[model samples]
Target: MAVHHPATIVPTKLELLQAWVPHQPWLGGADVSTVTRLGSYRFDDPDGEVGMETHLLSTDDGRVLQVPLTYRGAPRVGAEGSLITTMTHTTLGNRWIYDGCHDPVYVTALVRAILTGGRHADLYAATDGGLVLEPATTHVRGSGSWSSADVPALTAPVVSHHGTTTTIHAGVRLTLPRVLVATTPAADASLSGTWPGQETPVVLATVDGSS
Candidate 1:
């Protein structure tokens, strides 16, 4: 529930990790770019328009990045995964925190609210966490998908050792797990948890790498 009103702006999550620590790939080289807070939560979105956040960053080498810092008073357009910036104010007016999950309408409303067990923010307790608390369960979409999980065709069904048993071709027979992706007029379906009496998830082709 931070994000006061836009008196001014700039990256505030430690200046966006000093401009995102040389583009982060787990970051390397010994230097001094510390960001130690370790705990934070909250994301309320009723009428107060809250999104207050904090996670912490810059552990270097070992890499534990969650590095969040939100304070929305505006910007819930299309959220997804999160990470936005525009906040910075000091003359005592405060307000301007952008980056609300890159805004794909708040990442499909936090991926349809984690597939239905929604409750965003699990940075683990530390004063029970902070920021303002939002995803207290709203259906955070969960067929285990941040976009259908790790994308090598949504992970699962593999049996390789020259046996050549890499799965997800899903032409369909029947099982307990289904994630079909071979389209023409919408054939394959069933992502478990009752989401597939058919709702349109029939994308055909492309699993060249494996999720």
Candidate 2:
């Protein structure tokens, strides 16, 4: 389960994206001001220390983009280049945001999910009354069915980016399509998602164990 706080955050997620997204080379020079939030999905961190979420945003040109992010209370060692920004959370205090593709915690969770048929984490909101179950706006599922597959421990994964996709090699190879599309590609195992306006599931990540 993923718990969310009702408290406000300085430099809201959208604001940060507005200042950062446009500069990404994969978008083909798209503008952030015209971007709109489509939906988001979450993967639970077993240790519960890091927050993993993937946001789906739509561009004015009808292109949907995928941005996976991880939130940490402190800086992640050796991830200075991947740091998105630092912001204050009213309830959680200081937070260091990093692109999930470069975070080990996220890579572990993602690989596990894809290899074990994992689904999106349940969402809960912390309120004055208590923890309340909140409906998730986006849904995701992994295609793998190897429930007993041993997930290899990954450390300091080698990451690369090109065009509209990013690839990570850490025992298991993962292909993350930054730009969302409608068709699902062939892969050993994969992750796909669906949102409100986009009910048709679209492939988000693909896994190849050949590595």
Candidate 3:
């Protein structure tokens, strides 16, 4: 589960995206003003060191894009190339943002989610009275192994395919779709889900280990 602290963040998520989105190779020349968030989901870090989030956005032309992000208390070592931006949080202080593809926490959690049929992490909002369940805008379901404990951490560099897929080279190859589609290719393991107004199950990612 994910817990949200009642803290303020400078340059909100959308604000940061506005400045960084246009620099992406796959979204070259795209206008950030027209981008709209469709929904989002979260995954918990077993170690509780980082925040993992995935946002689904739609471009003005109707292209659906998936953006996975990781939040950290400090800058991620050797991840300069993947840095999205740095911002300050009212309670947490400075935070470094990176593309989730380059973060081991995110990679491992994603693998575990797919390999264990994990569902979206439940969210809780910190309030004066107590914690309250926050309704998630997106829902996710996975299919594969049952235990995430056996999954090892990713040690090698993650590979990107045309910005549409992210591949982690661990003991077994894991791939996550960066673009949403009505139909997706099958795999040894996979994740699918729906969002508000979209009832059909859309493939979110796949995993393959046959070599």
Candidate number achieving the greatest lDDT relative to the actual structure: 2
lDDT by residue for model 1 (17-83), tens: 5665445332334333554433333344544444545243434443333322446545545443343
Q: How many residue-pair clashes does candidate 1 contain? A: 43
TM-score, cand. 1 vs. native: 0.24
Indicate the worst ten consecutive residues by lDDT in candidate 3.
24-33
Considering TM-score, which of the candidate structures 2 and 3 is the better prediction for this target?
2
Task: Give the TM-score ranking, best first.
Answer: 2, 3, 1
Residues 62-137, candidate 2: write the lDDT tens digits. Answer: 8889988899999988789999999899999999999899898898888888888899999999988999999877
Q: After superposition, how far is residue 71 of candidate 3 from its true place, in Å?
A: 0.2
| Best TM-score among the predictions, by candidate number | 2
Cα error, residue 56 of model 1, in Å, equals 6.4
State which candidate, 1 or 2, has the greater TM-score. Answer: 2
- Score candidate 1 by lDDT: 0.33
- Give the TM-score of each candidate: 0.24, 0.95, 0.90
**Model 2 lDDT on a 0 to 1 scale:** 0.86
TM-score of 2: 0.95
Error of 1 at 144 (Å): 13
